[model samples]
Target: MDTIFYNVMMKSLRNGKQWEVLEELAMEMIEKGIQLDNVSYSTIITCAKRCNFFDKAIEWFERMYRTGLMPDEVTYSAILDVYAKLGKTEEVLSLYDRARADGWEPDAVTFSVLGKMYGEIGDYDGIQYVLQEMRGIGIKPNLIVYNTLLEAMGKAGKPGLARSLFDEMIRSGLQPNVITLTALIKIYGKARWARDAFELWEEIKSNNWPVDFILYNTLLSMCADLGREEEAEKLFDDMKKSELCKPDSWSYTAMLNIYCNGGEVEKAHELFREMLGSGNKLNVMSFTCLIQCYGRAKRFDDVVEVFNIMVERGVRPDDRLCGCLLSVLTFSKNGEFGSVLICLEKANRRLVHFIDILDKEEATLDMVKEKFREILNESVVEVRRPYCNCLIDICCNRGLTKRAHELLYLGNLFGLYSNLNTKTEMEWSLNLRSLSVGAAFTAFEEWLRALIEGIEHNERLPTCFAIHTGVGGRKLSQGLADSLSLHLKKMGSPFQQSEERAGWFVAAREEVVLWVRSLDSKSLLATA
Candidate 1:
């Protein structure tokens, strides 16, 4: 009957209805006065943990103890696992203490869980104590124990300790597995210790250990970070040629990023096609890489093309991609106003096309306004704060003061994102420069006229910029919207530091033009 109950409960747990089955069985047992055995209680406790009902698990455990059934090794291990995941380090210690006091020897599984718990909390000494206790009890440390300790050491930034542990494991006649190697590789890669990482790779190859997909992917990522495209390509090819291992989605993404970062768009595109052909679902990072690749080459058309493909495929554009699109549309490295205008106009059209596809009747605006409307809408996509900042600057540069104020309104509705600094900004400014083809403003008056023309509109900030802060929008404090408006109004001042505010004040010149354009309204200055 006990064997039958256990089997029935196991099936229920596997089917994800463990709690219901356990409840019914417990009632039946109690009504019949069938004394539940250690196996029955242990199974209930284990099932509760697996189902993530920690409270219920604890209840079952306490009831088992009250029933005068002393837990065996499996029960102890299950409870220890629950405590570890809950970060109940104190409870774990208390359990360990009672088990030892009651003359119960901790087994390999128990010690392993304890070691992992200690490692997670950076309690290296605790880990050492656990190992010593295991040895004292004559229970030998196994591969799983070593791997957990090594991973903890790596996470704690104690690479030296991890290496020592690896050596100790080897000296004990236990071979390091792929998990062990991957942990060490991650540590070296993070520290940028290329020599050690390569040495470990060579050791793995020489020892005839199976070079799996994860190992290759890890090394490829390391190469990408270190800017070693040639080596990354070779590793990628090796993975492709290997009969034992097949590259997965991660493998293709890593190689694509490597090629893109190296400015080899052609190669990146080739691998992208291969990834698509292999039936691996391409992720947002894949599309992000390609957008960044074309942006680097100043091919805004390609950037928009890829972005269209991404949305059309139902892959939502994230904040990261929004930053990329903003850069591609706004910053032109070559100060050719003509080319910049042309690119902006083309991008503007593409964005409008996107809005048309969405076909929301509520989005009633011209091409430029609708484009921004879609960009800032969180229900559509969660645009990051940095992207918002960039778009604001883009609007300012294009003489879309109303549009810029409108973005500020959206920022208010969406809540302004702090820590505006990001890598995308650096990449944008570094590659973007002036492309010259237009007439030089030799006269001050001519420059002033041009500057005013760029920012002639005198739209009220609050009225035009107000976006409905719905459930998805972040609620901001009062006065933030006013402050943002004031800062933008001051941008047209001759004293406004365009050089310091790289994204905002790039093209405008002349004190009068700057001052005039900075007004809240043309009528305000006129009335004054």
Candidate 2:
């Protein structure tokens, strides 16, 4: 009679609508002196996970263990779900090992979760192993398993393999769901196999599957990839009308890209403003399209304006964003250079301030980490190699060696490579106007050491040249110029006057060049 009552109570709890109701029922059962069995504990844990009450789920697991109850594969899988939600990959793996040790074979749900984890991390081999192991245990691969493996293959750059698997799954009589079709479309889209992509899209439409946001986004992306702006626009309009698929930031970004790349800047700008007014949280990618569009049109004032507003809105600029802005500065006419510089200077100062805060003695290491994470999340750091090079170049030109060196060090720590061009740009930007001959030589040596240190680990050593010259109307004295030339010649570096840029002495070694402006006749050399 008691066992029958226990089973009845477990069933009621399992079917409970809310986790709170289940918890209340469990407490009531405990007060009534009812013994909860393994089924009872498992139901509670599963319910807690479904409700996102991970902490409560963990407590129930611990309580079950304390009561000397062994967790079944279902119980362990439920616990793994909780850990997966918490993103504790190690714990998930650890529990998997424990389940195996306890002689509990994993079920399909367990395999699915493990496969999904492996797929996410691009561990194609692991995903395959999980699938094979499931078969070894007599568990047939389900549609979810096949879909996950296909997606994993695509992500791992084995699109051919992914397509083969998709065909295999279909032949095995497993119906490809919407997710399956989307993943296949993405693979075809990425490879620019337009025919295959369209074929798959036609299947989706023929099936009369409910058109959702993911499907529209995927199709729009495919159209964008094929440079079919008309088709992409039609899809976008259809997406707007669909009650099921509301436009979000990603969808907007894809459409914006289609317009921008098509040279429809006005349309892109109109959509951009609408996106802004839509109260969507714009990410860095969202702004990059318009920035690049303005840059392509040489509307630099608009480029700078957008960049300034991006920063003003507290959007942390990434390397791509900074690179876009730098490209603007690099191509800007001399008359507009100063204005661009002013905007860049403002942005740079803000970055420097953040760097300074990270250096404060009172800021704990953990706090520094938190701040760095916040900077990354908030879109303020310019960490891309090109952008870092641009920042380093500006710092070098402005005689901010400490800041430049710090940036170089940070770049190195961040695994940014110093390419030959990047190194040359830095050396080219080095100004020697303020340093005396002796001071200039010392500065040059320090710069060379720092440059070499930053790029030593790179697979290819880039030949670099430094062009250091006096400021406008100020040139190196004859004696100092000659001394510098003699030093280069003594070091086996070749020195010759550049016929093109007057007063410029070009010296070359095996991989490094030193360009010195000589005022041997007291005439100022043009800045390179």
Candidate 3:
């Protein structure tokens, strides 16, 4: 049979989804010396794609190129999608450029595929380039392209860019669907723009727009993050009332988180019971949130009860949960410490061992640092800050000032704390914004000693110096700032709280130098 006959049969089989027969016929055509043309190759490549035979599609694409036959627009788009699905980003770019150079205009489907590929790799610039190229070629973006771009921007944390794109989509006379609104909501949530997210959600409800489980869960999760207890309660009620959707495990977890964070422990416990009665599987996050709530309320017995329940249910404690348990240890009474340690041993034995070493009088700072490093190395990166904070707080509460300082220094050495001290040409600054009170005190003493050393070596000092103790947002941090203020006054230090800056204490260079010089050897030795 001629090439045209084989192409016709292959096209029939491709349409019928008979991919295996299609491949066989393709091989028969090649063996029979039937010179495959562009049409024949395109049919096989399309069939390969439909059957998820990406490698076969690439092989045929290369074969067609070798025969000096350029793929038509449809084939070019198909192969681009194939390369994208295979994650061959370089190949996709090269082929896309070749197609554009050959005067092949990308259709809406091509643009959508390219946008999705860029989104997968988090290449925001590449996604923007695709949009620009589409508009440059007089191709207006459709709903799919806009949705892809918005979702990508949301993940990239570009809320402003996402908002503009969303507005432009509306201005282009395209209707904003649930997906579009959901993406905007997620962008706002990630940027912590709670006001914008709530406003958009209100608009959705006012318009009676359709909302799915994912969208509901996204909003509830945002509410949990922003501590919008009232809003979350209302939304949870609406979700329960919806005939189109029902709350799942994630919905319950998010609501639980909201109530826990708001200190509504009774409400959280009620929801927890409802979740269990509804047969929803309990997870680590739900347990962690409840434990944190109990810890905050100083309900130590309840904390132990919930932790035991979590273990009984086969939900393994994650790093965050372990960190949470360690934090509870800082506030726990001596009698309560052993029980919390027992629970922590199940989550992470290294943490218990570190605590045990801290209790040992003979345990040196080096031993403590080594164990701390081991625990940090085993834990995930997200838990590092909290773990360090909990350990430092524990040491401080136990009156282990020297150990706390050493641990804070080790944290700096491990790159957990950065920019604690910064020197610019005009100002030298010490930032204790993220430190606990005990850690901040040690850091301040260390900074003062460094200043003395700099002066002794005749190193030039900036004309002004500032120490920032973050005072707003967190009550605990406010106490830290207040303690530092009192300490500075007691020591007759030259640094004074800045009236202009809420969290800053500034000192003039001349007074600071004089204060450092006047310090006797005993005072200096005490700081050391």
Index of the highest-lDDT prediction = 3
What digit string (tens of lDDT, one per residue) describes model 2 on residues 148-225? 777877777667778888878878888887798888878888777777777776776786754567877898877766
lDDT string for model 1 (1-528, tens) is: 865665466557636756767756775776787777887788788878888888888888999888877899988999988999999999989987987787777788888898888888888788778868987889878999888888777666777777888888889998888888888888788777777888888888898765677888899889877777777777878888889777888888888787877778889877877887887777888888887777767776666667666667777666566556655555444353344334334434444344233244444346545565555564234445555555555555555554554554555455553222112311211111111001010111222333344456542111111111111111212123333335435543332324344323222224444456455554442321
**Model 3 per-residue lDDT tens digits across residues 157-222:** 679888888889878998878788888898999898989898888888887777899899999988
Which structure is stronger by lDDT: 2 or 3? 3
Between candidates 1 and 3, the TM-score winner: 3
Lowest-scoring 10 consecutive residues by lDDT in candidate 2? 519-528
- As for lDDT, the candidate ahead, 1 or 2, is 2
Query: Where does the lowest 10-residue lDDT sum fall in candidate 3?
Result: 471-480
Clashing pairs in 1: 333-432, 333-433, 333-434, 334-433, 334-434, 334-435, 335-434, 335-435, 336-435, 492-514
Question: Clashes per prediction?
Answer: 10, 3, 0
Which sequence of candidate numbers ranks them by TM-score, best first? Answer: 3, 1, 2
Report residue 260 deviation for candidate 2 (angstroms): 3.8
TM-score for candidate 3, please give it. Answer: 0.83
